[model samples]
Target: MHSRSERELGSGFPAVTTPLHALTLRAAANSIRAGELSSEAYTRALLERIAATDANVQAWAYLDPEGALAAAREADAERRAGAPVGPLAGIGIGVKDIVATLDQPTQLGSPIYTGARPAYDANCIERLRQAGGFVLGKTVTTEFAFIHPGKTRNPWRAGHTPGGSSSGSAAAVALGQVPAAIGTQTNGSLIRPAAYCGVVAFKPTLDALPFQGVNVFSPTLDTLGVLARSVADCALLASCLADPGGIPGDVEPIGRAPRLALLAAFPWVATSIEQEWAMHAALATLRDSGAVVTPVELAEAWHDAQRVHRMIMLYEGAQQMRDLQAREREQLSAKLNAALDEGREFGDGAYHAALARRDILIAAITEWLAPFDAIVAPPASASAPADLTHTGDPSCCTLWSLLGFPAVSIPIAVADNGLPLGLQLAATAGADERLLAVAQWCEERLAFKGLL
Candidate 1:
């Protein structure tokens, strides 16, 4: 953590002597707009913090302090000159390497595009800038947003995987290196990392945000998501990206406790003893808060959801990366190549069947969600595992990704081993705003403050 330099406290906005990088996205923006803090100073503080701590976390893939500082200076100048300011003005955000950025190189966590820099900003990045947020750097990601792990390590526990794809984004936010960051989820890329790294991860309803410049990995399930320290920060990013005009000025109350359904276990698997205890504790907290918690499960019709999800992901992923496999087979990881091979072998008929089966399950889950504000489940079977080679299993996240529903993972507790545990809350597709509202309510009630 970096300390703020001695400076005169401005008139209205009080000067912040504490570390500036620890503030949430909304708070930083508010402070910057009030002239209490300079965006350049804020960004510089974060850059210094990154310099200090990133060596241990290894979360960043590409960083350009000069470019980031320049952008922050412009924001400060614009604010001082009485120019129109967006809600996210001066807020710092980290961009996942898989997402295209005009400034940072998008390496896709592989040497295939080691120095590839896109000419146009990804739609998400474009809107983030328009909202006055500046990209602090590009965070590391899994190879092609798949199971391949990156160099990023869990900030809470060293030598453990921070989970995939969104590894850097989640680690950066959890360690207070950045207030918020953009992450993409195809198969738990966003939620898994958030769960393992102990941060808030939000994957809105499919297509609710932008993915125009993101690398395609199962278009049916691909989603642009975010990670931050708090639910309000996630909501702020979601609101700004969905409709900059509709961004809430602050974290507003949802007015009532959400009627949530507690799913104790996946239909195909069971939770570990520690996971069970953590989950039950979360449910108990909600019940004590006067919220209705119901137990539910998907019947035989959904028994194959996880299997079918993999079918579709593999089929679509293989088709998407066909050209790359044909030309650069050596560059691809064995794991990824094996997946692609399986996908190619999966018949077109099977792929279509899987898609149809997925649609049926979506309808079933939608009906299940109709009677509740949201559904609560475990984000993973355990906390960040001790191994760095494997980025944990994706079974817990497979069904949600297949459904393309809005999902939020909030860190609710810690395991006996000291790794962080996340509670997964999801709503029916297109219920993103309500989901965020309910999620914020649950987040406050759980009161499981992070250690980092």
Candidate 2:
């Protein structure tokens, strides 16, 4: 594998350079736009880095070096012409394989459709490109963004699962293979993997980024998000892909300590000792910094979190992929087929009841969160588990995903085993702007450090 020192970045228009792979998406774009970095050179540097490291990491589903360079070179030409550039101009982002792209196959990480290629770009892809970015490639995802884990290995430690189903997106960003990548979460898919991979992941409120052209696992629960190195970098991407005109600007200028609730309250879910330590350490840091942190209760009202999330996921997922099963039953994973069978057996009345309870829970949670700016918790039950066949437990993420609320995973500490431990902060539904601000404040206080 090539060391970081061997890879270098060059200047834009003329000739400039840095360790392009290490920079955040927003920072790289600024460098490129200012003629201090060439988009093509930067893109090439990453592709080379990925080529050197991807054999072990396996973070990509579809990579087109030629296509990426062509777009980057075109961007350089546009910049040289003194043309106006978008905020993301010259930056490259990895689209989760589930998100369709015009040029790459949208492999859902299932053997049933190994080479499925959609003819059109997902709605967000078009918006992303229009805002001055190009698709670097498709990152790996768990089959159908469901329970099945993908082949992506945790970049920080080998033989450990990177949390899924947004496995590759988080691993790519953490490995410095790409500045940022998009991922989807039905439950903990985005946040858990990012926490495990030691990167920043932001799952904005439901429908913040349209789901059109992307495969649906559970329409109500699934939401697209970005995994990057830092909160501000995530903000840069969120400003473009999040609900148009809804994203907040400059989360840095917050005036006071954010009112946050420490939600260590899931009776149904238990945290490992390592997880508890990480949470306490993070809470101490935040408390020391003048933020008001208080323990909050959640299980009393939503005691059936995991069960309800699974029910909805199975119900919707089964219908969404019914055709795939009908045509390619033999090709599907045994675990997936079993889940599909369970989904097929879920009663329609139970599904409706789950939806009803979802609404009720959202209302209750909204009221409870009226005072605090955001709720804080551990990203998962523990850091990435040693097992690769099973993605780590996602119980911590189920509540927020169930409510369609915005959640961000910020790496705050390290585990005894040398893996990352993260803090999960969630905001009320549609309160994403404030949520970003709160996350920024917490990020600043925590000052997360990664392997890169």
Candidate 3:
């Protein structure tokens, strides 16, 4: 079992050579824009690093070294041609296997579709390409992006599991294998892994980014998210993925002291003792720093969020993969197969009722969020668990996903055992920009105080 300790807290892996790797992303882009560094140089460095470190990490499901270099060369040529470069020009991004790419295999992390490759790139991948981001390769994902564990181990502690189904993407980012990667969440895929790996993860409102061509787990709860080292980095990437006119500029830092709502009881769930303390420590830090941290009651309906999320997920999972089950029943994971079976037991009326309840919950939570700039809580029940047999609980993420709210996980403290702990912040629906702005403020404050 992984335990958090002061020494383990905030100890991230070394930086990678790829422009998409956080440390290199800005510097590489700055150099290339100034004609001081060629895209080839950056790409080469990244490819070499991946070759050196990825074998044991198993963060990648597919890697196309030649294709990556070719793309980088093209980017360099475009720069020499004096063409306008996109915001992410020459950046190398790792894609979650569930997010299809035309140039790389899309395995969806399932033995059932062991050799499956989609003909077209997923919508997010298409957008990234259009933005001048080169696909480094497809990162590993849990089977069908479900609970079945992937091979990724947390960079902070090798024997521990990197949270899934976005395991590879989070691990890749945490290890400096990639600057940023695209991940999807049905339950805790994005936030949990990001927390476990001690990196920044942002799950924007559901449908905030295009989802076409991506493998679906739960249509109602599924969300596209980004994993990065910093909130600013996430904001920058998010801007690129969003529609040109729709994307806002750098959020002007909020001038007034930020008002934050702390979910006192967190609905029906009870937090672990360690998690409770971590939150208390975080809240204490924020309060001492002048941020208004007020206690607020979440909507009563949020108590059923987990069940509602599961009902939607199981129903959608069964519907989406019914054909696959017919042809490859034996290939599905036992856990997923059981889920499908359970889903089949629910009548359409019951499923529809759950959907209705979800909508009501979203509305109530949205209303509850009116007064606070953001809501803060523990990212998970505890630090990454010792057992890799099961991915940590998604309960921490259930409320936010159900409400279609934008949520960000920030590494706040480490436990006594050398594992990292994360603090979660969620904003109202459609207030993604504002949420990010508040996060930036919190991040700056934390950094200034040496609390990160």
Candidate 4:
């Protein structure tokens, strides 16, 4: 039986009346501060929305309506008591199940780990709670944050995929179940899902946020990121989670115009005709806005990044799940079991060599991006969501993730099928603030010109 408070929380709030449902963490905090809305009220509304739509989308793994409302009420009481509120005060955040939570079951999208709960919240979740955020629920993730798809479906079209690993986080944000959600990426989990679902996603430089308590898939490549409605929203959530002060001063605006390097060819993955047109259209918009765009060919070394990512992932994944494989081999999904089998073949020498090569590739990519503010490229092979059995290719995102570069996916165009297309922009390693500033500037310009 559910608690009366929980049932009340789920049923008490009214539906959102407006069509535009882009609620930012900053905006929610501001509204709370201004007394325009109560934290409890806002959280209740989001819970109601999730109750209405999440059944079909299957975006949540575990929802705690009672806990969320209790947290919201606590935040409101803090404000009434004249306590200072953080930037994310009163906002509801969906935690990826791969990231542990003391209050909810952390299943990591695996049946073998069913009903598992950790004693401590993940580092990022703890930070969000400290900043006065309400944990709305746990979002669905692929099995062990690998290739095994979850039950989540795209909100735009029911049968297609919403992308994986971070599937539910992307779908919830896209369908307005929650304003923003936490996601992780070892390969293309974050950016690929964001692109497929038509939302803004940001993958900060590697190790930007601490990953303590989160389930490890690939230690070196795993990164925490966020999905939201706008670039500014993504930045704000990142800032709160990371608590980086004063927005680094190096992010300079492109005074006259910007120079963008466009990758015309990718050896590992080929763009479809629709994707090609989308890329060209986005490039044309940038050029028409008085920017210089040039087609650049990547070095042959980049062609091997996908394979390198796979090797490192399999090696590390096998190590992470060794205990599980030993204890619950039959309970594991076929995709996960296959990955473990493949990982067992690689020797330590091959793994170390792959790491060394990754560093070299990062240097090469950084040098290539030195002359430009950012690189403009297609985010995925297709403009819209594909079949639910597999997440779209992360090949477009693998090199950038391996290099530890800051990457952002901006929703720029809609495909003929009425689904969204994303334009990805990447910057040099540790230049995330600069990359975001440029992205915000470009997003605004494009939106004004009706190109976004």
Would you list the C-alpha lDDT of every candidate in the order shown?
0.86, 0.85, 0.79, 0.80
Clashing pairs in 4: none
Per-residue error at 10 for model 4, in Å? 22
In model 4, the runs with Cα more than 4 Å from the true position are: 1-22, 246-256, 448-452
Sliding window of 10 residues with minimal summed lDDT for model 1: 1-10
lDDT (tens digit, per residue) of candidate 1 on 206-306: 88888899999899999998888999988888777775534343556779888999887887666788888988998898899988999987677678998
Leading candidate by lDDT:
1
Candidate 2, residues 75-156: lDDT per residue as tens digits?
A: 9999899888988888889989889888789988887668888899999898898888989999989888877788889998
Q: List the residue pairs that clash in candidate 2.
A: 9-17, 10-16, 11-16, 11-38, 12-37, 12-38
Pick the winner on lDDT between candidates 2 and 4: 2
Model 2 worst lDDT window (10 residues): 7-16
lDDT of 4 by residue, 1-452 (tens): 33221312234443343322345555667767776567887787777777877787899989889898898898999989988877787788988999888888999898877899898888888888877786789999998898889999888777778887899999998877788899998888889888888888989998887788888988989999888877888877777778456233233454666778988657888888887887787778878888798889887757788888889989998988888898999988888899998998899999999999898888888887899988888778885455878877888888787877889988777778867778888899887887888777678676521111
Q: Indicate the residue-level lDDT of 352 in model 3.
A: 97
Q: Please state the error at residue 208 of candidate 1 in Å.
A: 0.4
Score candidate 4 by lDDT: 0.80
TM-score per candidate, chains pooled? 0.96, 0.95, 0.91, 0.92
**Weakest lDDT window of 10 consecutive positions for candidate 4:** 1-10
* RMSD in order of candidates: 1.9, 2.5, 6.0, 4.7
What order do candidates take by lDDT, descending? Answer: 1, 2, 4, 3
Clashes of 3: 11
